[model samples]
Target chain A: MLIVGGGVVGASIAYGLAEEGAKIGILDAEDSDFSASRGNFGMISISNKGFNNLAYFRLSYASSRLWPEFASTLREQTGIDPAFDLKGKVYISVGDREFAAHAEKVAEYARRVGAEYQHDILNRADLRQMLGNVRLGERVTGGSFSPLDGIAEPLKLYSGLLNAIQRHGGSILRDHRVGRIQHQRGIFTVEGPWGSLSAPRLVIAAGLGTPDLASQVGISVKVRPQRGQMMVTERVEQSFPYPVSGLLRQNPEGTIMIGVSTEEVGYDDRTTVSVLRSLAMKAIERLPDLGSVQITRCWAALRPRTEDGYPVYQESHERPGAFVITCHSGITLAALHKRLLPQWILGGRKDALLEPFGLGRLQSASAA
Target chain B: MRPPHDLPEPPHQVSFRFGDEEIEAWEGETVATALLASGVMITGVRAMSGRSRGPYCLIGVCHECLVEIDGLANQRACITTVRQNMKVCRQTRLRPLTGEDETREQ
Candidate 1:
C-alpha cells in the first residue's frame, strides 16, 4: 500500500493499515509544506459540530470518544505520550448578548443531537469559580462547557503516529511530493522529482495537495484552503480547570495557545498584524489577566476545507483501488481514520457512518 | 566556564530591598546586574519545574530574570532600573491559583 501526503491524516492511515500486516510506504512533502496537521489547535471538540450536518457531528463525537484508547495505544506502541486531555472545554462570551447567543446555540445543538449531547451553560460566577486562579474581564458574561471537548498535543500525536508506523514496519519517504501518478493494469505508479514508487493500492490523504493527485486517479476532490491565524503566549502556570474550547488553552508545557480566525485568503498562510492584534484584544477582553502576558509567537495555517465544510471520503470509480480522503478536522477524526478507515480501504465492510461523506453527495448536490 | 571580565567601579551606587536583604547597585546598572554584583545569583524559581533560575540574557529578552517589584509581578529584572528602597521579591508561580505549588520553598 502507498499513501500520499505524510501529514497526520496519511500517517494515521498508514499506521492503521500497517497494523493489519500490509506493507506500507508514505510519501510526505518537504518539511516546509504548509501542513495543517502541524498547525492546528489540537482541539478534540464535539460541541458546535454538525449543526447543519448530523453525520459530521456523529463522526466527530465518535472520534472524540475513541481518543482515549487511541492515545493509550499510541503510547504503548511508540512509548510516546500524546498528552490527550479530555477534562472538558468551554467557549467564553464577553457580554450579555453574546452569552445569550452562545447559550442558545448550545441549546440548539443539544436539540439537534437529541440524546448523548451533554453541556453546561456556566454563568460568569460559575466560570470564575471554574477558572480559580485567573480573573475574567468585567464584561465577561458566561460560557458553555462541553464534556466531550478536549485537547491533545498535536506534534506529539503526529510524531507518535509516525513512530508507530515505522515500528509496524511501514516505510516513510520524506520530501517526496508526488508530481505525477499513473494507474494501469491494477497497479498504481506514483512519480515525483525525487523518485518513483508503485503499489497495487493507493490512498491520497494530502491536505490541500489532494485535489491535483486525486484528479489523476479519476477523483475530483473539491477542497479549498481556509487560513487561520493563531498566537502563543509565554509559558505560564496552568490556571484554567480545562481547555476553554479551541480559542484558548494552555498546553502541558505551560505555554498558552490562543487562536484563530477563518479567512478566505486562498493558499496564503502569512500572519497579519491586524488579525493578531484583534486576537489579542479579544483574548484580553475575555480574560483580562492575559493582557499582561507576553505573546511569544504567532502563525497562520491553511485548513483543507471542502466546499460544504464536510470531509470527503471516496474511492475512484475510474481507478478501482485508488482512494481520496481529506478533512479539516484531521486531529479530531484521526482516531476514526486509524481505527475504521483502513478496513474499508482493504476491502472490508464499510462503516455506515462513512456513508454521508462520499463524493456522490457532492456530485448529486451539484447536479441537482 | 568562561572567565569573568573585570570592570571599573561605577561612579555612584543605589540600594534596593530583595526579599529582606538590602542590596547595593551601581546607579546605571539594571536590577539583574545589581543582583548579580551583590552575589545574589539565584533570583527566582521556575513556575513549572521549581528549578533555581537567574539572569540568563541580561538584555531583557529571555524573561528568565522576572521578579516581583513593589507588589507588581512578572517585572523583568534585566530591564528594570534600580531605585532606592525598591522592594523586590522572587516571582513565584501562581500559588493561590493552583494551591498545589510544591516549589514555593525553592
Candidate 2:
C-alpha cells in the first residue's frame, strides 16, 4: 500500500492498514508545507461537527470512542502520552436567540438521524455550579455539552501516531514529495523526488494538499483552506475541566488555552497584535484570574475545509482500489480512520456510512 | 564610487511580495511570521464586513491567516515558509459552491 502525505491522516491510515496485515508505505510531503495536524486544538470535538453530515458525525463519534484505547496503546508503544482527556466538552452561546437556534439545529439533526443527542443547555446558575469561576458576558445565556467530547495533546499525538506506525511495521518517508502517480494492471505507482513506489492501493492524506493530488489520480476533493488562530498560555494550576472552548480549555498541562478565531483568509497564518490582544482579552474575561496570566505562545493554522464544510471520502470510480479521504476535523476523526478506513482499504468495500460522501455530486462519475 | 556612511540600512529584508505591495520578509521564516515581524498588521478583509482582520492565532487553527500564494488561493501561509521569489496575496472574498462541482451536497 502506498500512502501519500504522511501527516496525521497519512500516518494513521498507514498504521491501520498495516494492522490489518497490509504492507504499507507512507510518502509524506516536505515538513515546510502547510500542515494542520501538529497545530490542532487537541480536541476530539463534536460541537464543531454538525448532524447534517451523518458520515462525518458517525466517523467523528467512532473516532471519539476509540481515542481512549488508541492513546493508551500508542503511548505504551511509542512512549508519547497524548494526554487524551474524555471529560466531555461544552460550547457557550452569548445571546438567547443564538442559543435557542443552536439547540433547535442539533436537536432536529439528532432526530433526523435517530441518534440519541443528549447535549443540554444550562442557565447561568446551573452553568456556574458546573464550572465555577467562569464569568459570562452580559448576553451570554449558557452553553451545550456533549459527554462524548474530549481533548488531547495534538503534537504529542501526531508524534506518537507516527512512532507507533513505524513500530507497527509501517514506513513513513518524510520530506519526499510525490511528483506524480500512475496506475496499470491493478498496481499504483507514485513517483516522488526519490524514485517510483508502487502498491496495490494508494491513499492521499496531505492535509491541505489533498485536492491537487486527488486531481492527479483523476479525482477531485473540492477541499480548500480556512485560517484559524489560537493562543496557548503559560502553564498554570488546573482550574477547570471539559474544554471550555469558545472561551477556554484548562488543558491537562494546566495552561489555559483560549480564543480560536476563524477567518477565511485563504492561507495566511501570521499573528497580529489586534487579533492576539482581542483573543487574550476575551480569555481573561471568561476567567478573571487569566488577566494576569502570561501567554507563552500564539499561533495560526489553516483548516482543511470543504465547500460545504464536510469531509469528502471517495473510492475512484475511474480507478479501482484507490481511495482519498479529506476532512477539516482531523483530530475528531483520527480514531475512525484508524479503526474503519483500514477495512475499506483492505476489502475494497464501499462503506455504507460513507456512501453520501462520494464525488458523484461534484465531479464526474469517473472521478467519484 | 558611492557610499553613504552617515546612514544605517534601517534593518529590512525584501525577500517576498504580496500582490503589488512589497511584503518585507526574512530568510527561513514562514510568510505569516515575516509579514508580522515587518509590522504588516491586517491580512485579508472580511467578506461580510470588509473590515481589516489581522492574524488572531499564529497557528492555522483559527483560519484567520489565509493568503494566496502564487495561483493557489487559501494556502495557509503560517506553515508555508517564505521562499525566495514567492508570491503572497491576501484573499478577500466569498464564493458559493455549485452542486455540479461537488460529490456531496453542500
Candidate 3:
C-alpha cells in the first residue's frame, strides 16, 4: 500500500495497515505543503458537528468513543502520550438569544439522534457549577456541554502514529511532493520530485493536495482550502476543567488556543490583524481572566473541506484501487481513519458509515 | 581584521536607562542579555491582555523580547545592540504611537 501525504490522516491509515502486516510506504510532501494536521484546533469534539448530516455526527461520536483506546494503544506502542482528554467539552453562549439557539440546536440533535446523542443544555448556574474556578464573563448566559467531546495534542498524536508506522516496518519518504499519479492495469504509479513508486493500492490523504492527485486517478474530489486563523497565549495557570469549543480553552501545558475564523481565502494561510483581534476580543469577552494573558503566537492553516463541509471518502470507480480521503475535522476523525478506514480500503467493503461521505452526494446535490 | 575570539574584549562596564531606572549593562551585548543580567525581567506587556512577558528563546527567534528603545516602539531587544545611555522601556503593545502621543511623551 502506498499512501501519499504523511500527515495525521495518512499516518493513521498507514500505521493501521502496517499493523495488519501490509507492506506500507508513505510519501509525505515537503514542509511547505499546507498541513492541516499540524495546525488543527486539536479538539476531538462532537458538540457542534453534523448539523445536517447524521452520518457525520455518528462518525464523530464513534471516533470520540474510540479515541481513549486508540490514544492508550499509541502510548503503549510508542511511549508518546497523545494527551487524549475526554473529560468533557463546553460551548459557551454570550447572550440569551445565542443560548436559546444553542439549546434548540442541542434539543433538535438529541431528538434526531435520540439515544445515540448525549449532551446537556446548561443554564448560567449549571455552567458555573461545571466550570468551577474558571470564571465566565457577565455576558455569558449559558452553554451546552457534552461528555463525549474532548481534545488531544495533535502534534504528539501525529508523531506517535508515525513512530508506530516506522516500528511496524513501514517506510516513510519525507519531502516527496507527489506531482503525478498514473493508474494502469490495477497498478498505481506515483511520481514525486524525488522518485516514482508502484503499488497495487494507493491512498491520497494529501489534504489540500488531494484534489490534484485525485484528478489524476479520475476521482473528482471537490476539496478546497478553507483557511482558519488561530492564536496561542503564553503559558498560564490551568483553569478550565475541560476544553471549550466556541471561545477559548487552556491546553494541559497552560497555553490557551484561541481560534478561529473560517475564511474561504483559497490557500491564503496568512494571519491578518482584523481576524486575530476579533478572536482575542471574543476570547476576552468569554473568559475575562484571559484579558491578562499574552498572545505568544498566531498562525493560519488551510483546512481541506468539501463543498458541503463534510468529509470526502471515495474510491475511484474509474480506477478501482485508488482512494481519496479528505476532511477539515482531521483531528476529530483520526480514530476512524486509523481503525476503520484501513478495513474499507484493504477489504473493499463499502461500509454504510462511509455512504453519506462519498462523491455521489456531491453529484446529486449539484444535479438538484 | 582579527578573528572574533581574538578580538579585544570591549568595555566590561556600560550603563543604560531602563524606563526611569538607570541600570548597569555590559558593552557589545544585546539589550535582552543586558536586561537579564541586571535581573530586570518582564521585558514587555501585551497589548490585548496587559500580560507581562519576558524574553524567551534568548536567540532572536521568539518575539517575546519586544521593548521600546530610544522612544521607538516594537523593537526586538534580543537582536538590538545595547549602547551607553540607551533608553529602554517595556513595550505595552505592538501598536505604534501616533504623532500626538509621541509629542505628549516628549
Query: TM-scores across all candidates?
Result: 0.84, 0.73, 0.82
In model 1, the clashing pairs are A90-A245
Q: Write the per-residue lDDT of candidate 3 for residues B1-106, one digit (tens) a residue.
A: 1114545755566789998888876667788888887788999987657889899987767778888887776567988887899899998755321222333244
Q: What pairs collide in candidate 3?
A: none
Please, what are the lDDT tens digits per residue for candidate 2 over residues A268-354?
Answer: 877678877888766655545556554667888777887777777777777877888887778777777787788887886656766
Best by TM-score: 1
Model 2's CAPRI class?
A: incorrect
Expressed as tens digits, the lDDT of each residue in A1-368 for candidate 3 is 89998988899889889988899999997888888876788888786788788888998888888898899999999999999988888888999999998899899988888787889888888888887876789999999789878878988998999999999999999898889998788899999778899999999999888888988888876778888899887555566787777556677645789986898889788999999999988887777766666577899988888888898888887888898898888888888888888889999876678788888877632221
Best by DockQ: 1
Model 1: runs farther than 4 Å from truth? A364-368, B1-106
Please report the TM-score between candidate 3 and the true structure: 0.82
| Candidate numbers, best DockQ first, in rank order | 1, 3, 2
lDDT of each: 0.85, 0.72, 0.82
Give the 10-residue window scoring lowest on summed lDDT in candidate 1 chain A.
A359-368
lDDT of 1: 0.85
DockQ, all models: 0.14, 0.02, 0.07
